[model samples]
Target chain A: HLDLHHYLLLSTESSNIRIYYCFRNIMKELQENFKKLLKTERVPVFLTSSGTGAMEASIVNFFKPEEDVLIVVGGKFGERFFKIAKRFGLNPICYEIEWGDYPKVEKIEKYLKENKNIKGVFIQICETSTGTFYPYKEIGEVCKKYDALLIADGITAVGVYNIEFDRSNIDILITGSQKALMTPPGVSAIIWNEKAHKRLGVNKRYKYYFDLEQEYKNQKEKFQTAYTPSVNLYAALNEALKVINKIGIEKIEKNTSIMSKATLKAFEEINLKPLSKNPAIGVSAICLPDSIDGNKLIKFIRENFNMYIAGGQGHLKGKIFRLCHFGYIDIFDTLNQISAVEFALNNLGYNFDLGKATKKAIEVISQYKGA
Target chain B: HLDLHHYLLLSTESSNIRIYYCFRNIMKELQENFKKLLKTERVPVFLTSSGTGAMEASIVNFFKPEEDVLIVVGGKFGERFFKIAKRFGLNPICYEIEWGDYPKVEKIEKYLKENKNIKGVFIQICETSTGTFYPYKEIGEVCKKYDALLIADGITAVGVYNIEFDRSNIDILITGSQKALMTPPGVSAIIWNEKAHKRLGVNKRYKYYFDLEQEYKNQKEKFQTAYTPSVNLYAALNEALKVINKIGIEKIEKNTSIMSKATLKAFEEINLKPLSKNPAIGVSAICLPDSIDGNKLIKFIRENFNMYIAGGQGHLKGKIFRLCHFGYIDIFDTLNQISAVEFALNNLGYNFDLGKATKKAIEVISQYKGA
Candidate 1:
């Protein structure tokens, strides 16, 4: 029910070359704009309905049935990719890590050295499961050395941390509409380099909607899609892109880095251990004291402050909680979250300095501003 | 670019249940508000993309590869269905009608009686390509007698005409966000009765994104979708529903009928032969004299007067021109269009009356009002 004017602004006239135009241009645009902002190389192009869609596209296009893939599982999103890969009939070799630690690149390199005919290597840039950021640069090199495609799910890192797609030579980089893009969840994108494209060219069709070749034809021909697109969502992404473009990508990365340090510093001041000793560059997953019930703590924060901080997913569930410092959020939002957590903890019969989190957040932000 | 407020005001909530609520409640209110509105049992549903998406879903779900279908071909949309049916491996029996004339139900019945194994019938309620509306009720009854599903493309008719889906026993009805809905082109709605549902349940897994089963699961839970949906488009649809609720579908239908007749009268007054004796209840298609060059005439009107009249599509291309008497256009818009056409024709070296079209338009509207 979007207005004609809204569409007229965001919509490129369906490619002028043909009458059918792109069918899913609106959905594609949302993912494309988000990826562009994240500095993802315009490779391995795919558009799907969910974050899982991106993961599925990567597996289906890259692997034949029963083909082997190495899933470096440091957190929830990593496990999700592994599940999705198995669903597509891939036999994944998972390298599991502790909730708060990155999957070791050495272990991955060792596996690749021994395994023959490896289909791909899967890893998450920032694992939402336990808030761990893997050593993407290192793992990317290892995957390259072994001649296996490095498939990175940059779902949580895309808009917040720097992801050098070309520099890292990432074969497949997947992301979604929500999280750092500041758009609502609905669309996902997968960017592939030349090698990935060549492989996809020879693959058989597994699904119609997630097919990259058709999506590419639709976009290149008319800046449209193969099916009806969600035009209103496209309009929202267009507006959000303007904001991101004006602020510049480097500035966004720097802001998130500053916010993450400040958040961690605040937790340190309160004597709470961060989930990961070497915390992810963007997110700070804090471990609530064992005496504290995380589910109750989460509910308390939501009810009292109307803030939605994510709980640990899957294996890390109830052990650690996450604080997102992503797109459209700044120092003020970070400060607010810190204060809300402090209030909830204090109300739940815990004694702590009321201004501890905010003070550290402001101090870190000031230091970063000076730098 | 659209003003952000305009975008906000024209949007709908993207959640599926929220959309269902908006649609059902708006239809309910429209019924109570309009004095002449019929209580159609087929309540409209909202989809996330173009009207074609809705039509495609209908075909993919209701018919298997071995089934036979009757395709009523008058213009592009009718022909489009034929193509889609073929793609799905259905042998579509073509019941051809001239671009501007409504297909004869008797002819269709004769074909149905002769052809065994026909499982479904596809018809365009308003042929957008040439502005003709088929006799849906008669065709529906014939299909009923033969126990075949009657699928109607009502993309251009839903908000403009009184479609009593219950009384007509139309099995599947498709409509779009644009056209008579006065919304941007993104979402489409496919409304089906019990028979069509059973048919869909038996269809093979042709697509994931377009899968009806997943959509049903998503729709039933949280009024969301199997994948990420267009949140902003949902918002826009929600807003449009409010406007429709106030106008009532009956008044909207009556208004379109009156406006349509007025335009038709204008054509007659100018000595232009009506393209169809039994014209569509919504739009007027005027066939130009061979000397006039309909395409050039349409161009002149669009360029000089900034009035966009559609040129004929497919076989009728460059031969006939059409004016929509659909949503968001009224007496003033009609008058302006007629005046523009008259001016363009005269300027293009054709002899025509200056005020005839506007006068006839007024008279027809007055007659409808008196009735």
Candidate 2:
């Protein structure tokens, strides 16, 4: 299938007229569909890079230099906001938390109350590094009470969960083409409310490429971007988003939840412990015993079973492995992942029930009736 | 073809280990082939965005705040450099020139002599906005003599022309995937010599997404990027670069030259004057008669002939139209463009000989047989 698509569209001129026209409409329609999916009136701006680009765009456009912003750092993605804010010369007050923990609304409120100049609170809805699903809705209420904008990185949380943008009062919501969107990476989407737009008024410090205002203006006027966008990627994303919309966000959420639950259940049957204190539905981080090598286990699974999963990032390396149950995945995929893990563990000389894990996963997944 | 590839590989998890492993080798091989195609020892850094991202990466990574740089502004891209430098707090001296005119090397030398603190000279090898190709080799010499870093935006130049990176003394050279690289617009490639790398030794102003040093380090260590790249785009780019390598750069240059010649000849037959005095080989900017509206002409071609061409940008809008003969384009495409223009003009009641343009085009394109 990859070869087929590559043969058809990959060889065309990058700026082909047909592609430009088709993608222009695709981008416009995609944004509209994204608004519908988020149940928001605010239009999502499509950026031509990864989720990190959207994160930086939000910081650079909405906040002023040296303006105090509160960053809730629980995992790697949370740390990203801190780094981007610092790079943009924003005064970021880090509200640090443990890697696998979630941010508390009270703590965020305390930070806001103590710091009168805090203009915004930056955080991740799902910290992919540790598979923790943060309570952004509660934090949003705190930010609202303090009149501080809430910028949530929903890269891993958007399509996997029901992210009602307007209802949740998220001023700036960001996501990427990868993750639950089920498209290849390259484009990121950022949807912000009028309050965030007002805050970004007349900003002149942003570089040409990342200038959100200019991109917004261009997109508004011509359904185009500030730079040459990836037309092929846009076409791919349009189709992916259409599939998600057809499946309905609620169904997707339920499916992802079921998969996550089944996978966790299977892991428990095999005596594997979940790593995150508050794990997200899209991925489950399983803590490996100190005696077992997590890296070796992952490598063995990839080599022997032809299955791939994530290893722990940063400080948690070699101690945990991540199993994904995100977009384009179903119960069968979850069972496969569990079986692979069981096989890998047994191959690594760890005592684990081989067939018991898959059986447990199947039992849990069998209860799901909704499509 | 696009459907096939999309069905197979486009739906995979972006950070999947198998995808990561496969694309890591693809990225490495693509860069190696790119270096060979450029015939330079300098390594090209694969950036996960459009060329504009690469342009910003160069500025924020190499120059410090309030540092002085010289920008030769002849077209929109040149103005982009000016804007980026200002955003990074650099004091940029704009050496302004007419949009269609090329910059003189002597003038650049004079500016460098007068401005002793100028740290770098930024210019575009082929400014896409006006189709003007500057004499970068001469400018590189001037920069070398004055000990100023030469940063060239080669977005529309690299694959279309034989740009000798090392011998030409170019400190920094940048290109995009959408232009001559024959790939979708997502990734950008930047190749720089030791001088530019040494200048970027310890700069930290760039955000995580655009941090060139970290990206370079990561790529050098494990053939990986600092971010999750678009795996499908990389696969497509690797294949495209392999094709380019097989054809050889010199032959591609000749083919592009023939196409450009054919286009210009066709334009001349229709009594349309070339807009740029020193137009690049990739595109031709044709001045429209005052009686005929350029925008209407372009729209007519799009609506009637179903062809895609560019109209004049910025101040030149409604005055000129652009004809692209860039990557993945051939003599047949050039003929089609000329025919469309002729058809559009004749249909719009502009008096011109029918079939004359294609005849003139064929006469010029027939001389090239190397490809």
Per-candidate TM-score, chain A? 0.88, 0.96
Which 10 residues in a row give candidate 2 chain B its minimum summed lDDT?
B1-10
DockQ of 1: 0.16
True contacts kept of each: 0.15, 0.60
Write down the C-alpha DockQ for each prediction: 0.16, 0.57
Q: Which window of ten consecutive residues has the lowest lDDT sum in model 1 chain B?
A: B8-17
* Alpha-carbon RMSD, candidate 2: 2.2
Residues A1-371, model 1: lDDT tens digits: 43434533332232111112233454456446655675664633435255776777777666766788899877667777777666555688888877778878788888999997786899888887677777888888888889999898887777676666777667888876566766544556678778777787444633344556777766655566665454444455455665676787788888888888899899889888788846775678898887777777777887777676766766667766778787756788889888988887787766788888788878888987874
Q: A153-262 in candidate 2: lDDT tens per residue? A: 99999888988888997999999988888888888989898888898744477556878888888787788988878777776777777788888999989889998888
Worst 10 residues of 2 chain A by lDDT: A1-10
The model with the greatest TM-score is 2
